[model samples]
Target chain A: MALDQSFVGRTYPPSRPYEVGREKIREFAEAIGDDNPAYRDAEAAKALGHPDVIAPPTFVFSVSYQEAESVVRDPKLGLDYARVVHRDQQFAYHRPVRAGDVLSVTSTIESIKSLAGNEVLDIRGEVQDAEGQPVVTVHTKLVARAVEAGGTGGAGEAAEGE
Target chain B: MTAQIAYADVEEGTQLPLRTFPVDRARLVRYAGASGDFNPIHWNERFAKEVGLPDVIAHGMFTMAEAARVITDWTGDPGALLEYGVRFTKPVVVPDDGKGAVIEVAAKVAKKLDDQARTVQVDLTVTSAGSKVLGMSRAVVALG
Candidate 1:
């Protein structure tokens, strides 16, 4: 089923603030094998002009993707979660994310299009601090493969009838 | 400071070395916990199957993070990055086995910035089962 075109350009409400903690930042850095001291040592981060231990660039994904649930999981959108492939991701950082900051994300459906029988979703997640300062903007593109019509269980067929 | 490759030393076709990193269920769970994602599709195979996924999958950010490692390691400093982006072209399906998945990433100097910093663009992809899990991915790093 094709997604609802009307859902395009829809904007979701701001998500609840997620507090950045030292432990979470530390864990994320360690999980990716990043031994950068700015991710774990507060003093070191301060010495480098950051208020606290700063998060890696991808850390915003934790907050942004959750905020995107308002769009991707919307029943009206008729999206097939199973067939969706992550297509692209880009981040524009205004400043480094710090441990003591509380952040919220507002997600919007930037575009919906069809290419070569596949559905593509472009979602923009704008993250801000508690005081409403922009921290980063996350743009994600996802492709949902079109379902094949009983063609002997081909490419997109595995995603159907879920 | 001494630099191996400087802004003036690189060109468009310069090929940086490739990197491979592991992605397992345990790491996915830890990512879910730390990031507060908690999406059932990343951790529960049953839920993933019920929702039309072949099996539990790794988070897109997980793949991107592994890709970013290649650039940061090459620069010798994480702070040397200015901007980065990628398209999650495929789902990294992690089958339930002790063996984890791997993401391979490579980079090059795509463009030069006006300042002393050069914009090093990276190309990255992840694969499993001889299938391309992610594609069309790129990252831009700032180097002195």
Candidate 2:
């Protein structure tokens, strides 16, 4: 099923503020095998001018993706979760997320289109501190591959994105 | 401190050191737990194949995190990064073999986006098994 184009520009409500925790940042860094001191030690982060331990740049994706689930789960939008694959991801940060900062996300559907028989959706997320200060802007692109009639739907060699 | 690279020392075409990140099933499970992205395609080979993927695949964000290491290790500060973007053109298929897979990264300062703030845009060439995994991979960093 094709997505509803009118849903483009729909902005979801701000999510509950999430605390940026040092332990979570450390866990994320260690999971990726990154030993950057700034990600683990408060003093190391402070030395770099951050008030508390800083998260790796990609850290916000975890939080934002969770929040974006609201859009994916929006029955009105009719997005089939299983058909979706990640296409592109981008982030612009005014500042790195610190250990103690509280953050919230507001997601907007940027665009909806069909390409190569796949439905492509773009969502832009605005992340702000508790004070409503911009922390980062995230853009995520997802593609929903067309399900063919003969069950060759997901099995095609076209190799859609992930 | 802020950025180990001297603002004056870096210019367009300054090459960053190459780095390699090893990926395996164990690491994916760990990342899935930490990142909360338990999309079975990343850990379950059977599920991945059922979804038309060749084998167990690493998360795109996982490969992205590995690519950024080349910059973070060089800057010596993880927070120095200002912007990062990439298109998932290819998946890094991680096999069940004990050796797993390796993502090789090479980067260079593609442009100096700012002169006063000491910011530069770095372009990356990331590959897995000699195949480009991320398209238009780029990052803007604060060298202040």
Candidate 3:
């Protein structure tokens, strides 16, 4: 099924504030095998001129993806989570995210299109600090393969162009 | 600590030094916990295979984070990076045989901009076993 074209440009409400923590930053850095001291050492972060321990660049995705639930779960949009393929992601950071900062995200549907029975939806997640300053903007493109598409009924079905 | 690599010191097509890192099941579990992705496909081989994955795969964000490390390590400050993005072209599948996967991250100076801030554009890639796992990875960093 094609996603609702009318849903384009629809902006969702801001999500509840997510408090950034030092432990989570450390864990994320370790998970990626990044041993940068700024991720775990307060003094190292301060020496680098950060107010607190700073999050790794991709940390904002946790909050942003949650905000995207607004669009993906919308009944009007008619999305099938089982058939979704994450196509692309981009981040434009106005400022680096640091620990102890509470942040919120607002998601908006930027565009929708249908190509070869696949529904492509572009969703934008804008991250802001407690003071309402923009921290980063996450642009995510997700493609849902139409159920009727041939050879898509089973698992392991790669999306087109894979 | 500001960037050691200044905008005036580099130009288009200058390749940054490469850094390779390993991605194992332990790391994937930590990533799932930290990022709250908690997807079974990233940790459970049985579940992953049932869902059609060739094997337990690393999260896309995990690979992006590795690429981010390459930039931050060079610049010496995470804040030095102003923008970064990537297209997840392939999955980093971690075979549970204790012989983890590796992502070789290499970067190049794609462009330079003129301004008081002195920003440089960096192009990055994450490859594993001759396959490009992440593509079109870019970063803009403020230089000293």
Candidate 4:
């Protein structure tokens, strides 16, 4: 089934503010095996001109992807949650996300297309600080594999050589 | 704010140092928890095979973050990163055994974008298990 074309350009409501904490940033940095002092030490970050420890660039993906759930799970969209695979990700930052910053994301459906029987959805997340200042923009592309004719509840067979 | 790297010192085609990051099942589990992307293909071998993956695979975002370290380490400032992007071309399949896959990343200055902002674009080549995992990976960063 094709995704709702009308959904394109629709912007969802801003998500609840998520307070960025030093510990969360530290945990994420550790998970990725990044030991950058600026990510874990306040003094290191302050020396780099940040108020406190800053998050790795990818840390914001957790918050942005969470905010995009509202779009992916929209009942009217008819998207198959199980068939989706992430394809591409991009981020443009106005500044590094720092601890103590309360952040919110507003997601907008940039485009929807179908290729090789796969449903492709493009979502752009606008991240902002507590004072509504722009922090970063996240662009995400999700590919929902077309359901097989006789298969149920699984992604379509992986495209050969993809 | 002063960037650790002085803009005058860098030139197009200057290569950043290569770095290799190891990814094991344990690391994937931690990444899954931290990123909130509990995709079974990253942690469940059976679920991964059922979903058409060879075996448990590391999260694409995790691979991307690992690649970014090349730039961050050179700049010495996470905030210096202005733009970053990548295309997930292949999965970094992680085995249950102790020896997990290693992602090797090599980067270089691709272009000098703005003199005033001291911005330069860096292109990265990332491989895991001897297969390219990310395509067109690049980062734009500001230097002093």
lDDT of every model, 2 decimals: 0.74, 0.88, 0.83, 0.88
Predicted complex 4: CAPRI docking category: medium
DockQ (C-alpha based) per candidate is 0.39, 0.68, 0.59, 0.56
On residues A57-150, what C-alpha lDDT tens digit does candidate 1 reach at each position? Answer: 8887878887776678887788887566567778887777889899999999999999878898999999999999999888877777777675
Tens-place lDDT per residue, model 1, B1-144, is 112356666777677787778788988898777666677878999887766667888877777787777766676545555567765546778877898777666566555545544565656555655666556666666656
- Candidates, ranked, TM-score: 2, 4, 3, 1
Per-residue lDDT value at A140 in model 1: 79
Q: What number of clashing residue pairs does each candidate have, in the order they appear? A: 10, 0, 0, 0
Per-residue C-alpha lDDT of model 2 across residues B118-139, encoded as one tens digit per residue:
8999999999998999999999
What's the interface RMS deviation of candidate 3?
3.0
In order, the B-chain TM-scores come to 0.85, 0.96, 0.94, 0.97
* lDDT winner, 1 or 2: 2
Model 4 agreement with the true structure over A51-94: per-residue lDDT tens digits: 99999999999999997777898989889876777888999999
Error in Å for residue A66 of model 1? 1.5
Candidate 3 error regions (>4 Å): A148-162
lDDT of residue B136 for candidate 1: 68
RMSD of 2: 1.6
Chain B TM-score, model 4, reads 0.97
